[model samples]
Target: MSTPRYALYYAPAADSPLWHFGCATLGYDAFTGEDIAFAAPAGCNADRWPQLTAEPRRYGFHATLKAPFELAHGRSEGQLRAFAHQIAAGLSAVPLAGLAIAALGRFIALTPAGPSPALQTLAFDIVQAFEPFRAPLGAADLARRLASPLTPAQRAYLEAYGYPYVGDDFRFHMTLTGSLPQDDVAGTTAALGQAYAAAVPAAPAVIDRLALFRQDSREGRFRLLDSFMLGR
Candidate 1:
């Protein structure tokens, strides 16, 4: 069997309205590993919403902190969990003005309304602190990553960190859909934006916890293992 893969991610508190909204939009709850009813936003049809969300549903609702990785040869899940706790303990929550639905390239996601220096530092620190636990990308994975066009800096990051989006290339976003047809982007974004504003509280969004998600196999959906409260 393929070794399980784990990811460090930022997710809203499971009991919060934002969490329910995100999970319902994607039609899957990673916390429970169960499919849920689709909460299609105003402009999207039910049939199309599922197809649009197919990709993110597999990984669950989250902003990537550290992308998925297999454990290093000498590392174990217990050790990773302990290390994650230590990292979270030292980090305070990051606050954002709010999130806005935006189209990133060809995909839809919720992005911060304003940049947060503290958030950037937290993400970078997680990437660095968790490096010891990540196995180097396999030959096939490395080749696949190289197949994508990358700037020199991104290429360097991929070689060093197993993911290209780090440092200046990183943007925190909770994905809402897979790549979309050019015609669909604007409408989808507008509709989801409306739904998001209605569903999510207007208060500032806080990155208060870090969640650990695990995928049992390449084809499997990632499930939440646990969450560590920041600075607790």
Candidate 2:
């Protein structure tokens, strides 16, 4: 059997406009692991989009609740599934007021319009709850993370959680692009804002489900493995 890495993510429902727009923009569907053809944003170069979105497209459109990790030794995929189900049953859904397109460093992403304490709590809980199943970062993985300049708190989180961004450092973002060139940032940001406006509802977005995604290998695209409803 292939050793798959898993992650817990908050992806929009397949039927939602946000899902359609996100998948189209990225040109890859996490649910089906298929490439899609979509129009470029108005006044933008069509040829540049595929290259621009390539990195995030591999991971699909979702906010990371639990960063991807391989299963620990002696752990089974079934055990992880049951644990995720248990976690979902105990947590209530959070209602995000809205999402807006914004710059996250050099990349663009959809971020929550306002603070949602409930969302933060849920993300923190998932990180802690699933720590046991996460395999320790291999030497190469650890080295790669350490090579980046990180704050003390981020380093501590990396040691404790196998990922640097967790707990207080966590900021929910569904990535839209890889690092963009300086000249492209302004135009791309505006384009994303206009393109995603219809998909981001004026009303609140309800986070009522948690999805499990799997990647068959380090180079593979993640695909939806299963979904568990919240508050059940």
Candidate 3:
């Protein structure tokens, strides 16, 4: 892989019950080393973990509100850090209505149970407010993301953002599993719903902090980089 570009990500608390339970409940793999290799859970292999089949092991449970961006022209790390500090400083604390496990396309995802105005605005702010820092996407990068089937609009987004999912195309989701097979779609959806119903609490989840995460490009595993308490 080329030198990995820096990105801003909204990560979950590393040791929170949210992280532990969410990570374990889903079949996402843990980091083995600084490389991409990962192992399936000993008791539950791929065949049993059908939902995990379609997703690559690199990206696991963390929900990415704004996909990582390369720094804009001449922008230095100090400037970026300053931007982070300022963004964190001014951002209003985002209150959350508890998100639920909903099927996002083919995967199991975490989505807002109620209209989360704060969360939605926060996501939009993270993307737009940082536009001053976003580096332009290149032809080679565009060519690569274009490998996947997409509408002309999605292609436009990939050419603009490092990722294709954004704007009207964006649906805030935290992927829990990979795409499901046709035969298992209904059953798997029901199974996942049952699992979440049995597992997730029926209480409201208050948003107090914004988490930052990083991945050593070659390594598939991601680690908590930093976290800022939402002062809003």
Candidate 4:
């Protein structure tokens, strides 16, 4: 049996419009651990929708803060939970102008419309503050990460944090689809942009809470474990 892994993420409140839009688009509700049907955008292929979104569906809908990691030898889930609460209590919310649908590499996601120094600092701080709870990456995991082409800095970060995209290498994104074929990128982006506009409300986005997510097994979908409001 595979051991459970945990991650820190920023998921909008369950009742919020952005949360509903993301969960609907992915066809899975991380909070409820249930599947919800989503209509394909007018010009998109409904039949291919599942294939395009299969990967992100597993993770559900959230912007990753601390990438998934197994608990360290001495850490218990209770300790981790208390730590998350402590960390959240001292941090203020990070506000954004809003989110924009954008293509990142081959996948599409909701990205911040503009940069926020506070958001970046928050991400980095969590990565370091939670380091003690993260076990070292296994050999197979390390090999898989190294297989990708990474800059010297990213490789260094992988060695240190077990995730290459932390610190300065991180770009906050709530993934909307799996990597698409080069030929499908343009059309997919257009369809996703339109769908996003229709589904999500017009409001400034804020990172107001930190959610703890758990994956029961290697093949299992992640689900919401708990959420702690910031500055509470």
Best by TM-score: 1
List model 3 lDDT by residue over 56-136, tens digit each.
335545667667655688886567666776787788765566778776666667776777666767776777777777787
Per-model CA lDDT versus the true structure: 0.93, 0.89, 0.61, 0.93
User: How do the predictions measure up, each by TM-score?
Assistant: 0.98, 0.96, 0.76, 0.98
For TM-score, candidate 1 versus 2, the one ahead is 1
Q: Please give the lDDT score for candidate 4.
A: 0.93
Q: Which parts of model 2 have CA positions greater than 4 angstroms off?
A: none
Full-model lDDT, candidate 2: 0.89
Root-mean-square deviation (CA) per prediction? 0.8, 1.3, 4.2, 0.9
lDDT of 1 by residue, 1-232 (tens): 8999999999888899999999999999999999999999976888888998999998999999999999999999999999888889999998899888999999999999998888888898999999999999999999999999999999999988999999888999999999999998999899998998899878788899999999999899999999999998
Residue pairs of candidate 1 with colliding backbone atoms: none
For model 4, residues 1-232, the per-residue Cα lDDT tens digits are 8999999999999998889889988889999999999766668788888888999999989999999999999899999999999999999999999999999999999999999889999999999999999999999999999999999999999999999998888999999989999888888889878888888877898899999999999899999999999999
